[model samples]
Target: MRIQSTKQLPSLNELKEILSQRFSGQYSVKTFGAGRKSILVGKSTLIGAEISIHKNEVSIASSPPSVFGGILMTLGMTELALFIFPFFFKHKSGYRTLEREIGLFLQHQYC
Candidate 1:
């Protein structure tokens, strides 16, 4: 859920700019509130990441993909499903892969 690096982290704005440059062309990226949070939408998945200062580390909270998430939201049941079977979603390799890529991107960029 959080990525940490020894590399000097950029300011929030800079970090967001870096991320935007990486993801904007590839995903439908929606940035909110001055580089604080961003949502990146892909074909069957949408991921949200927030860059925040935690202690001396710049921590990023990244959300995973949801297949058919629109339908679930329309029916108002994604929350219920997540509440009941959270691991069901967290276990997806796609999510893991995305998370890894994001982490690596930050690590490589800053390091």
Candidate 2:
């Protein structure tokens, strides 16, 4: 997802700090020089976001969980039996929310 704003965007260092604090250990965040960042949300290496910022837009790209991760998650959810379906939906929704939150934070924060 890409968020476009008329306001000037925050600097890379500022963005890194803000996101790190916002995640507060729930997720792992790392920033590369020149407007690149990666977020790891869980133990699964496949679930995360790659972020890039340029000019007035911030782009957040999320990858689908790997087949291995998906199988592991499904196995983990099996303990809930009939309730497993809802957990998948909730997981997807949560990831979407995470992306939106990051985009909004960047769109609104000043450098």
Q: Pick the candidate with the highest lDDT.
A: 2
Q: Residue-wise lDDT of candidate 2 within 21-103, one digit each (tens)?
A: 87776776776434345433332444656676678777787643345665756665677646666656656666677677776
List pairs with backbone clashes in candidate 2.
none
- Residues 2-111, candidate 1, lDDT per residue (tens digit)? 65666666665566567777887765444444544444434244443444655446555554334365344444455566463654455456555666667677677764
TM-scores for all candidates? 0.55, 0.56
> Ten residues in a row with the worst lDDT in model 2?
35-44
Each model's number of backbone clashes? 0, 0
Kindly report which residue stretches of model 1 are placed more than 4 angstroms away from their true locations once superposed.
32-45, 64-91
lDDT (Cα, 0-100) at 13 in candidate 2: 64
Local accuracy by lDDT, each model: 0.54, 0.63
